[model samples]
Target: MSGSLRHGSGPRSLSEIARSGGPTGSGSFVYDEATLRSLISKWVALADHYDGSMRRINLGAVEPPGLDFASEALSKSANTSGTAYLKYLEQNYRYCVEQAQLLQDTLDDYLGVEHQNVTELNKTDQPTGSQSGI
Candidate 1:
């Protein structure tokens, strides 16, 4: 994908758009498909890394140094903190994966429209033979 694909920017020709092979926009912002895909890949990678890291962590395996009340309190606090931290990581992973999926869907749609436009243009540009068979 290339830059300069806009929704209501002043004016654009089909050839210019076809040459760019860029994004589809709604009103103001337009994203380049290639750039978008790269970002999406990063997001997915980040999410997967986070998920794998979280899976490797075993907060429950941690034990207190002593069997005293203070140790028990510390253990409970650690568990609470660990659970909260894991929750945060889970949310972050979900957000990253979700954003990647959304961007991927948008790119797919843009590609579909671009393909259709090219197909239509080719149909119109084709040379039709005359009925006279000359």
Candidate 2:
């Protein structure tokens, strides 16, 4: 665009929020609905991307020991290495997913909460009806 301030699609009901409609209107939070949606989209996509990537790593498939070797020491060594690698992969996978999920969940929750708060605020601020007839 140009060197001017641009606003997003914003809340459907603007009258309730634009009490001032000037610099520093309503409250601290200007409430940009579009920006919130964009952030949520990114967060969800990241979560999905991570989900796809992390599971694709087939770390659980360990190679069997050399059958031709036929030595107890070799078998024991293979078992130990296999267990260690498996455990490492499992722990790291869990940890990475947990962190990604935490971020995704937090963003999702904020989006829900902000949307709900705006909707409720709009409902409450709206003119109930004309009391003139009563």
Candidate 3:
């Protein structure tokens, strides 16, 4: 069971790895609270950056530079490609934010379980009246 993802004979690309939730071979993921929090922060930051970039890319503000048929065709193609690229960026941003939210939720659940376990243990640790070490 190789942890690394492969495409045919070659390793998977970064985008693939990202889409697949990283290179966890066995599908078992483990992370500390700090690591999870950090990952959430980074993902949020990336999403914010992408959100900013999407705002800055105002395709409607600029018109095609030429009026000829050939130029029009070229401009149309360029706009189409640009729109697609923008969509890709938007998807990436959404993915990042979603990943961040997942991590945060997982962290919260983990902490809740941990606290419950601790509370249970603490209850057991307290000596009952019948078991008082008099």
Q: Of the candidates shown, which would achieve the greatest TM-score relative to the real structure? A: 1
Worst 10 residues of 3 by lDDT: 114-123
lDDT of 3 by residue, 92-112 (tens): 988876676666556666565
Each prediction's TM-score against the native? 0.60, 0.36, 0.59
Once fitted onto the true fold, the runs of candidate 2 whose alpha carbons sit more than 4 angstroms away are 1-70, 113-134
lDDT (10s digit) by residue, model 1, range 19-38: 35533455444467677656
lDDT of each residue in 23-93, candidate 2, tens digit only = 35354444354554444344434444444555665543445456565655566676777667666655654
lDDT, residue 51, candidate 2? 49
Error of 1 at 66 (Å): 2.1
The Cα error of candidate 2 at residue 111, in Å, is 0.6
Cα deviation at 94, candidate 2, in Å, is 0.4
- TM-score of candidate 3 on Cα atoms, chains taken together: 0.59
RMSD of 2: 16.3
Model 1 residue 22 CA deviation (Å) reads 11
Candidate 2: TM-score?
Answer: 0.36
- Give the range of the ten consecutive residues with the poorest summed lDDT in model 2: 114-123
